[model samples]
Target: MAETTVAEVMAELATLEDPRTREVNEKHGDDHGVNLGKLRAVAKRLKTQQDLARKLWDTDQTAARLLAILICRPKAFDRDELDAMLRAARTPKVHDWLVNYVVKKTLHAEELRQVWSADPDPVVASASWALTTERVAKKPAGLDLAGLLDVIEAEMKAAPDRLQWAMNHCLAQIGIEHAEHRARAIGIGERLEVLKDYPTPPNCTSPFAPTWITEMVRRQQVE
Candidate 1:
């Protein structure tokens, strides 16, 4: 992996005033992994570009990287920017990490719901740990889940057997978070059970099974 210091990353980011570099940074931003220290330094000098922020929208890995940076140095990002980064993660690890460390995490019902409604992935899946209230608000219940499901389903069908498992994991999260979609996942799993699946997904290697639908599903159950 390429190594960079906090100062270096900041300097590189500073020189990123060039539109191409900035655009390149935005395009490849999602691939930067676990650089909490670096992101914090950048957030400390938060950029004022509206277009820059829009670029990172809904990107889980890049969002998580940014979230880690801000959480490590909460004062760096504005309250709204920090919240936007957190919402971008929608990942369980990033969400819980923020809740536990950032605010004594004593969020009221609606606040937590807004958090849950974040985009799906390991980020959103980990939200099970955030179930602090009797009725956990569902953020994405009315979301465009159908579209997300369709995207994954098409990928699964189009992909080769080697890529099938990887696609299943992505679909699996959608299945649980969106209950109506779970039946499709369940149906696919039933078929896969007979077909005997193999290989894992691209970003994550989660499998396809009844229990594999995940905590995101189970949490939404009682609510």
Candidate 2:
């Protein structure tokens, strides 16, 4: 791929637009979906287009924002800027992308998580829990897992909707990754009835923490 300016990339994005994909994406919390494959191609070609990312993120176009999240260097923004970005995430899909691709990928992630987890804003707290889950899955060292489970057990039932999703995810990750916490996490899930009534697809395990944890363990065993 030849070097391409941000303008050229934006033009390419325009050409790749699919209204049908946009419609489906909006149903799933995005304003648009310029195919993921195309986004990958562009990201590969323009790795860490930080300047472009800032401009694209400001546009707030969902497709452009997805590309922005992909191309931005994690270190490009300081904590305040990242906090603002998290606050700007207006949709769940965008928030998830920012958590996974931007915030969790940063060197400053742990520091930010500590602050955000304690924040009063539900979106900020949700992002913190998302990062916490990743940390639990990959590197459990130094994390106060017991404290996390205590909070989840106490507050999950009354958490804001987004926070509840992430708190449940954290619970599941704890059960899957830390054997000591498995039974305790499952007990909490049973008590809270987390996602017990949420619809699950055929062949998919329930998203309730215990069942979700078991499904993860089963997959790990197969792998």
Provide the TM-score for each candidate, comma-separated. Answer: 0.32, 0.88
Q: What is candidate 1's lDDT per residue for 167-201, written digit by digit as tens?
A: 45545655665566778766776654622354556
TM-score of 1: 0.32
Global CA lDDT computed for model 1: 0.46
Per-residue error (Å), model 2, residue 211: 1.0
Off by over 4 Å in 1: 1-34, 50-170, 193-214
Task: Give candidate 1's error at residue 151 in angstroms.
Answer: 7.4
After superposing candidate 2 on the true structure, give the runs of residues whose Cα lies further than 4 Å from its correct spot. 1-7
TM-score, candidate number 2 = 0.88
Ten-residue region with minimum lDDT total, candidate 2: 1-10
